[model samples]
Target: MRTACFIDGYNVFYGLVAGTSFKWLNLPSLIQHIVHVEAPESQLTSIDFFTSGVKPSLASRGSQSKEAQDTYLRALIAKGVVVHYGRHQLEARNAPRFISKQSPPSRLDQVAIWKLEEKETDVHIAISMYRLASRQASLPAEERVQQLVLVSADTDMTPALKAIKEDFPDLRLGVILPHREGTKRTTPGSLKNHSHWMRRLVTTEELAAHQLPERVPTKKRPAIKPEYW
Candidate 1:
């Protein structure tokens, strides 16, 4: 059976890879490993990676994080991963955040900060899934994709999944939840409820097995992994 994998890049980052040593991830290898573990009969045929560029204001630890991300993106393209980009937006609004430990909690205290948010990524992922499902539904069984794998913990994708399940009853859908802290939520109920199969977590061992090489050679230049990553 042929399969396609759709990844919500930021969602996976914050849910699994952030603050971890697995930043140099190899999407192709990851998909293969996932398929071997979760759906042995399925062959991964495509990968769609959705993400946004880094904002300028954020202070980065290593050689600018933006450069590192660009390098990674290029490497992914070299390996046949389709990259769909959104944009990061800076918003100024009054919002309540966790109180600082140094200061006493005050009910009236509010802070106005420049919050950077990635926009359109979820919408893009949803639209891509819808299009893929539509394509499959329109084609004959032999020509259609048998399975679609979604990697994310975002609840925003639930509606898309539900619709696909309703419309393409024969298509197999799987959800892979990025490994998350025990205190934090795992997969959203709606997403899991609609999927044919759900893998609750991505283990560290799997991540270790699928990391991109420290130095990835590209046509334009050598793409080096960020030292601090």
Candidate 2:
């Protein structure tokens, strides 16, 4: 049977950026690796990646530490990873953060940075799954996508996933957990509706097998001001 993979770029990336300090993985190649682990019996027909186009440095986080983020994201696209993007968001509000009053002591010499939060990533993922699901079910006149496997932890996607399972039981829809700290999705009634959540993609050591080519990265992640705060 033909299998398809979908990735929630923002959801998965946020987990890595928050939980761990390392952020170097060949995403396109990563999907290739995930294909085998998720559907060992099937070959991938598509791997649609969804995310917003905003770089963290200037948008919300303002962290130059995220310098290589755009670089790697574009690299995935060059390798033929399907990328879906949403616009960056801007809002005005009281942005409270932590700051040290150096007068206290050396331990109090730090500052906190905050910015507007954009929430279009989840929307993009939902739309893709819905579109693919509809295309797979209704048999689109334009294209035909076989099986679908959504990779993310956003419980918001539960409804769409359920649609595939109930409406198209034979469609082969599965959910993938975003964080892979040896953790698993355990919503009390999550699987009661559908038990198809898989683990995250390839580990760090196996990055070589999943990296996109060398040329693409240089183009997508251009020379933007550093994002480190």
Best TM-score among the predictions, by candidate number: 1
How do all models score by TM-score? 0.89, 0.67
Whole-model lDDT per candidate: 0.83, 0.59
Clashes of each: 0, 7
Residue-wise C-alpha lDDT for candidate 1, range 1-229, written one tens digit per residue: 8998999888777777788898888978987788768888999889999999876458454438778788889988878899999998888976655667887756577778887888999989888888888887567877789899999888888998998899889889999887654435645798889998998877777878889998777777877788877
Which number leads on lDDT? 1
lDDT score of residue 73 within candidate 2: 61
Question: Which residue pairs does candidate 2 place in steric collision?
Answer: 29-210, 30-210, 63-227, 63-228, 64-227, 64-228, 65-228
lDDT of 2 by residue, 96-191 (tens): 343466534344344444445656777677677767766665665335555677777777777777766777666776665555454453433462
Mark the 10 consecutive residues where model 2 has the least summed lDDT: 220-229
